[model samples]
Target: MKGLRKTITTAAIGVLAVNSLVMGGFVSGAEIVPGSLQVKEFRYLDKELDRISLEKTGEPDGTRDGHLSLLIDAGEGTEIKSIVLKTADRGGTDTGHGIWTTWKEPSDIGKYLLAVEHDGKTLNKTFKETLGSFKGVNQFDLYASDNNSMKDGEYYYLEITTSAGVIKSDVTPFADADTSYAPVLIREFSWTDLTQDKIGSAAFGEDGSTDGHFKLKLAFAQKTKVLSVILRPTDEDGKAVSAGIWRTNRAGVGWLLGLVQGNKIINTEFNKDVTAPVGNFRGSVTLDLYATNNGSIKNGQHYVIEVETQFGTVISQPVEFGNKESIHTDSTVFPFKTISLKLNAKEAAVDEKQVKLDVAPFSFEGRTMVPLRFVSEAFGAKVDWDKKASKVTIAKDGSKIELVINRKQAVVNGAAVQLDAPAITRNNVTLVPVRFVSESLQMKVFFDEGEIFITDAKEQ
Candidate 1:
């Protein structure tokens, strides 16, 4: 009760916590670990009624059909006995005698809001058995009936009886006066192929007979509305590939093709809204990706699943179809070159091969300066000096850079770009800022512990 307190407020939801009870329950050498128990309030609308009929409100009268959902993630070797919910007021009472023994069928549980699916099956577990049965994160819905509903402004707390002892949640209102339930999408996992053997991997066959499947495990907040889910082919950098790669002349290879729930496969047409179960939020769906004519996915192609929801877009990590060797030949593909330089060191390493520098790198005006010729040539750029103009030009991959001595401005491909420090002559060697030159050449630069690393590929 006397610990850290945190509060989270969103457009349609607000949660107040005490004693480190926001994401997890308060710890006093208890069985449950810290930051594992999450409780949220959601609008529990009647399944038979129109969703638009309910107005968002926080008044006591407005909470007639609201519910509280507790997401419990017990630590290893933990066992939960029962969970009790009661108002903070001293005279508050538990209409069900503070213990939930009766098991509500999955169908009955879906009547209220905050339903969820697990492994493509409707969540069917009693409050006492949710954590133990799931063996991981589990959601338990508390109905807003006369026996369990909380008043609008009343602060309520949960008493979870575990194998160790009784752990209590912080005292907080069930729902904020102004908060409503907003939909949220949390991606659990994504895999390619039918056996789910290739997680986040895709493969294509020559005849489309071995076409791959992209599957996703997505968890949503209560009342979340999805707009569209797209499986788009992309490059190694996760950028979408050229259009028409998704336009297929083959049948059954259409976009938004398959929805897998349990053992049932629901075939849906393209551009149609893929509705998640009414009250369930945690669900898994399978999408088919086949190679067809112009839309055929090439070898080494990467892809990402974009879930456009009412809230916003949720994109998964990039999944590659085949090995990079099958796409880019050794002659055409070049491995990223990493150039390492240390402060005041006369030696530098390009891909771990030492190269002698005419002048050691040093800091000037808080910027790391290196020999312009050596650094430019290290990245395969041509450097030329114009003695009359006191300027140096570096050309690489169609980009031209011109820098003048004692001038803070540099011209990059006909555009004037500002430099932090002007090129200076040190020990008869032209020194320039390493960051500006490397980044301008489309390379990434990182500095740490008196060392600088430059690479053509983005650093992880």
Candidate 2:
């Protein structure tokens, strides 16, 4: 038997029990990986080389003198350490009952051959051979691991030559093989160290934008690929809202993922963002995420971040939006953290040189509604009014936001945004919610003492 035990030892039997747990603790070894075991095709010639079976093996006629061979393939990630050939052993000295290796022809019926063809060359290998019985099941250990194990994507098979007895030795193949007896699979994954770093959002002009945008950083030791992102924004009372969460595309032409709903995302396509998580990293990804000031994304609400990777879904701690939300950090984070994005900046102190609006903004239903021209012009934004169309357009820094008179909706860069309040005319001034200029123009605005302080790249 070439040092191969005729029966499974206690340790080998132990695996059988543990594998049973995955498939209800009642299936076979094949259940270890669930149908990962199967026989492909086999062929054999009778004693006189007159009869052949180039298909699935059926019951032999117990005739003597023959040669047979089988071809086997394992599923991915499957490690075939050993295999058991099962056959019924009819009682009462079955006359033709016996088997041997086909080493030198029509005499041997037990010796198996293993080979791997690569680059037009074939390499022959050895296998531990054994005949065994387990749990009242007649099983032949046709092949077992020595230094040579049945790895996935390798060629392995058994060849049998009968001495009149080979016909009696019933050989069971994978097609009819029981999975409950199959071996376990070893799954492999591309290891990566991915983590979320500082998470902060500013509702003020702190980052040069008052419309309310948040910044988050993700760190990894190597270049990583982002599969998907899920955002869940809730108000003070914890109600779901749609927060427009997006990231700049590689082409820089536009943004990807225009919107996210109650943390649900329908866009599944993703790009590979190569990041260095181990060095003195200063480049951080800044997403302009904010509450649209609508009922769903009102300021002072809490939210969470959920992302999917190859391993599984990764979740972030609950974070509040608006104002400056505290971020989470790790000791492993790079010491030199800097603002790499030109769109983000630290808020400047209340300077004497301030771009104050001519008409002080007033509160409408708890919202600080300001005149579109004063707010836009104060921040270097060109304001255009179409008296014929009754539309007000505010263009600044590659962005164009338009609002219709007495309308509660505005179009930002061709994307429509619904508002909680409408633009109204007061004393010949087209007063609209501060959000139009803040969120739409991404210009941070702070209301203090009835004066609207406008800040942007110039001020920052």
Candidate 3:
């Protein structure tokens, strides 16, 4: 028994001596022992854990302490092939450990090692987290009922957190709609109220009927108060029609305020302060319209007009209005058989030089206004000029085209073609349609008055 004990003691001493020598060599930067192991990697075993409630009730009722996910990595020269999980608590009280973990297949997450020093000896554990190919959501949207419940606003929010970071989106709140009303009848003309005092008709309309254009003759009582006109056609429900108000001069000069909603018109209160002098001024006002509760304008249809006070809630009665033909022609006197004009050219010497052409009549303005057909034909387009409204339409291959003269712009097939010069009415003849100037040079044009309009359509 003594011999056996002695032999065991000697073997243990030899092993200890060798281990100590290796440790010393490594610490002193000398060569390492043969066949010594080295660590090579580190990583977290799980990329992400399921969302969990942090509120703890001491029972597994879908709530618990914040769970910790483990990170593992390998040290230099050694890969941690496996790991085991264990928990410790300094106090004896029972505390929650994370979900039970076991050795499993390494995941797509890169391999890494966890290291700890115990009595100057390094121990390593490997960690890897699972990863999967991401597939985008089929439908992802955030919506809000109201941003502000009391003030008619829109409000909503979305929140999300990922390994990359946390994210949030918000929408503000708003109020509800108010009551609405409409003027079913309107009329305006030079009038003296019960006082028989001369006053511009800021608000007037014939009562009890919705027919015939009620001419509005405005006589400004105050130059500071501009007249605002509104026109709407509505169903018995008081829903408004898509209608527009226009101001014109005795010379037929006019301005269009495109299809405007009556409610919004009242809400915005536009044109209530335009200055006009008190005088016997006669001008035509036309109101284009859409059906009540409808957003579309009826081509070549009747409309209603309503004029309102400059600084009051009073609305005019509805006025019946009509649409005159936008174009007319008088072939009785051939104004032009031959016409000639200059094109828009930057440099006369460049390839972009303007093309000048002459056609037959030579009768317009005695100076020979350019023929609409001749100019459009030069640019490979068929021309159609409306003599009544002074509108010119050009087309190529069955699709309508555009023409712009000086200050006039025309639409061909739903596209606006603007001009640099005003279309002239000379010698009882409409000189030129604007579309000729715009479409000829392959340039874009836009109209800016009270509103802006744009168009770009070319055949395939």
Using lDDT, give the best candidate's number: 1
In angstroms, the error of model 2 at 115 is 70
What TM-score do all the candidates reach, one by one? 0.31, 0.24, 0.16
Q: List model 3 lDDT by residue over 167-188, tens digit each.
A: 2212112212121011111223
User: Which regions of candidate 1 deviate over 4 angstroms?
Assistant: 1-334, 458-460
Model 3 weakest 10-residue run by lDDT = 1-10
Q: What's the CA error at residue 233 for candidate 3, in Å?
A: 75
lDDT of 3 at 411: 54
Give lDDT tens digits, candidate 2, residues 1-460.
0000101101111111111112111112221223343333232211111011111112111111122223222323233333322222222122222222212233445423322211111112223232211111011112221121111112222322121111112222212111111010111101111121112131111223223234444543222233333455645443445554432211111123222224532232223331101111112332333322223333455755433221122334445554343343333332111111011122221222323334455666545566677656655789988989889888877878788887867777787765546787776778876544554655333222233333332110
Q: Which 10 residues in a row give candidate 2 its minimum summed lDDT? A: 1-10
How does model 1 fare in lDDT?
Answer: 0.45
Q: Lowest summed-lDDT stretch of 10 residues in model 1?
A: 1-10
Pairs that collide, model 1: 12-180, 24-36
- The model with the greatest TM-score is 1
lDDT of 2: 0.32
